[model samples]
Target: MRIFLLFFPVFFFCGLLHAQTVKVEYGGDPLPDKDRKKIEQFLQHEVDFYSQFGLPDTLSLQLYVFENRREAIDYLESINVSLPIKASGAYSPKLQKAVILGRENGRERSLAIIYHELSHHFVSQILGKRPPSWLNEGLSEYFEHCTIHKKAVRHTFTEYEQGRVRTMYMLGEVNLPTFLK
Candidate 1:
C-alpha cells in the first residue's frame, strides 16, 4: 500500500508534465504584423537556399525576433548559454530554435542572420545530436556565408585547403566513436 501510494504521485506528475504546453518568450523590439510577415518570407528564402545543399526536409525550425542585444542577452541568460557577441542574432538547437535580435532595418542584414541560425538548426537536426564539433561549427559558418552570397558551395573547401580552417581529417575520424567523444 505504501509503495502504491508513493508511485501514484509520480505517475500523476508525469502525466501533468506531458500535458503542459511550452511557452517561449521573445524579447526585443516589438515587431509589427507587417514586419513579421516579411520576416517569414525571408525565412522561406533561407529554407530554399539551404535546400540546395541537399539538407534533409524533415528538419523543422522556429524563429524568435528580439528588439535588441540587451534583451537577447537577458533571454539567453535564462537559457544558460554565454553571450559572446553583441549578436545581431543567435540560435539554440536544443530548443530547436533561432532568435534574431534587432530589427530588419534592411532586408540583407536581417536575412543573413536568419539564414545563419537556420543553418545551425538544420545541421543539428541532420546530424541527430552527435555530429563532430568541427564539422558542426564549419558547416554552420559555411551555411551562414552561403546564405549571405546565395552560393551553392562556399569557402569551406578552399578554407580547408589553405589551412585557414581545420579539415575534416583534423576534426578527427568521422565515425560515431570519434565524433561522440
Candidate 2:
C-alpha cells in the first residue's frame, strides 16, 4: 500500500506535466474565415522564413486582432503591459509568447508587425533571451522592412538623407555602438 501511494503521486505529477499545453487566445473581433486562412498562411510563411536561421519551431505563438486601438490598448493593458507602446507587437520571452494587435483597417501593417515580433521571437529563442538592445530592435525593424522593394529602400534612404525620416544614429533609441559593432 505504501509503494502504491508513492507511485500514484509520481504518475499524477507526470500527467500534470504532460497536460500543460500552450494556450493561445485571440481577444478581438473574430476574423472572417477567409481572413483567418490568409493570416494562418502568412504566419506559416514567416515561420518558414525564420526557420532558415535555425530558430526553434516550438514557439506556439498566438495572434490577436483587435477591432480598434481602444480595444487593442485595453487588451494589452489586461495582459499587464503598459501602452502607447512603440512596437505594434510584442514578444514575451519569459512567457514564450507573442501578442499582435491589428489595426482595424491596417491589415498590411499588422502583417508587418507580425514579421517584426516574430523576428524578436526567433532571435530570442536562438540567442537564449539576452540579445543586445540594438541588434534586437534593429533586427525587428529590418524584418519589418524585409518585403520592401529595392526602389523603396532607395527612396527611404533618400528620405533619410534629406532628413524626412530620421537616421538610426539620430534616433538614438537603439544602441548604435553595439549595433554598428
Candidate 3:
C-alpha cells in the first residue's frame, strides 16, 4: 500500500505531461507568419475547450488552403473526401487534415471555417468514430461562431438566432425523429 501511494503522484504527473498536444501543418499556398500564429492561437483555444471531453495523447492537424475551388476539390478528393459542389471547407478524420477554400478578404469567415473543422477533429478524437451528420454538422455550425478575443474565446448565438430557434421550437419545427434519422 505504501509503494502504491508513492508511485501514484508520479503517474499523475506523467499523465499531465502527456495530456494533449497539437501540431499544425500548412500546405498549398504559403500562410503568412502572423496569420499562421493567429490560427494556431485559435486552435489552441479550441483544443483547451474540447479537452474537457478528452483528447488523444497527440493531435496532428494538416491544413491546406487553396486559392481556387477546383484545386481544393481535387485535393480533398485525392484524400477520399467527396465534397459537394459548393463546400468551402472539409475535414478528413482518416488523414487528420482539413482543406479549405480561401477568400483573401474574408478573415472572419475563414476563422469560422477553421473553428468548424477543428470541432470535427475534436469530435472524432472523443468518440473515435463519426457521429450522425446532423449532430456533427450541428456542432460545427455552433462552434463556427467562436471568436477569439485578446483575453478569451467566445461562442454564442446572436439574439436573432436565439429568437429563430425559440420560434422553431415553439412551432414544433424541430423534429427529433427525422433529425436523428
Candidate 4:
C-alpha cells in the first residue's frame, strides 16, 4: 500500500505532463496577427515533435520579437543579456523564452531563426539540462532547415554545410565515432 501510494503521484504526474498543452506568449514589439498565427503554427509543429519524448507540465514558451537588430539589442540589454552582433535569435533556457530580430529578414529567414531558437528551447526542456554546446547548436541548426508538413517532414543541408562537409572529407577528418566523443 505504501509503495502504491509513493508511485501513484509519479505516474499521475507523468500522465499530466504527456497531456499538457504548450502555451505560447509573445512580448516586446507587437507582430501582425497573421505573423503571430504563422509563428504559433510553426511552434505547434515543434511542440508536437517534442511531445513524443516528453515535456514538462508547465511548458509555456515566451517569444519576444523585435523589429530590427537595434531593438533586439536594446531589449536584450534591458534584460541584462549582452547581445552578439551576428546573432539573429537567442533562447534563454532559464526563462523558457526566445528572442528574435524580426522583419529585417525575409519571412523564410525569420522562420528559420525561430525554428533554430525554438529547437534550443525544446531541447532544453527534454534534457532537463543544457546539452553540450556543439550538440545543442548542431541540433538547432539542423532543425532550422526542417520543413514540417502535415504528412511529412524533410531536412536539407545548406550550401555552407555541404562545403564544410566536403572539406572535412578531403582532410580525412570525418570520423563519426570521434566526433560523437
Per TM-score, the best of the predicted structures is 3
Minimum summed lDDT over a 10-residue window in model 4 is located at 1-10
Q: How accurate is candidate 2 locally (lDDT)?
A: 0.55
Query: lDDT (0-100) at residue 94 of candidate 3?
Result: 85
Off by over 4 Å in 3: 1-18, 156-162, 165-181
Stretches of candidate 2 exceeding 4 Å from the true structure: 1-27, 33-38, 84-86, 148-181
Residues 45-121, candidate 3: write the lDDT tens digits: 66766676676657777777766667777677677887856667888888887777765538677767878887888
Question: Clash pairs of candidate 2?
Answer: none
Q: Give the range of the ten consecutive residues with the poorest summed lDDT in model 1.
A: 1-10
TM-score of each: 0.50, 0.57, 0.74, 0.72
Ranking by TM-score: 3, 4, 2, 1
Candidates 1 and 2, the one with greater lDDT: 2
Q: Candidate 2, residue 72: CA error in Å?
A: 1.8
Once all C-alphas are superposed, what RMSD does model 3 give against the true structure?
11.3
Model 4 clash pairs are none
Estimate every model's Cα lDDT from 0 to 1. Answer: 0.52, 0.55, 0.70, 0.71
Query: Candidate 1, residues 115-156: lDDT per residue as tens digits?
Result: 667667666665666568787677666655543223333332
How does model 1 fare in lDDT? 0.52
| Candidate 2 Cα deviation (angstroms), residue 95 | 2.4
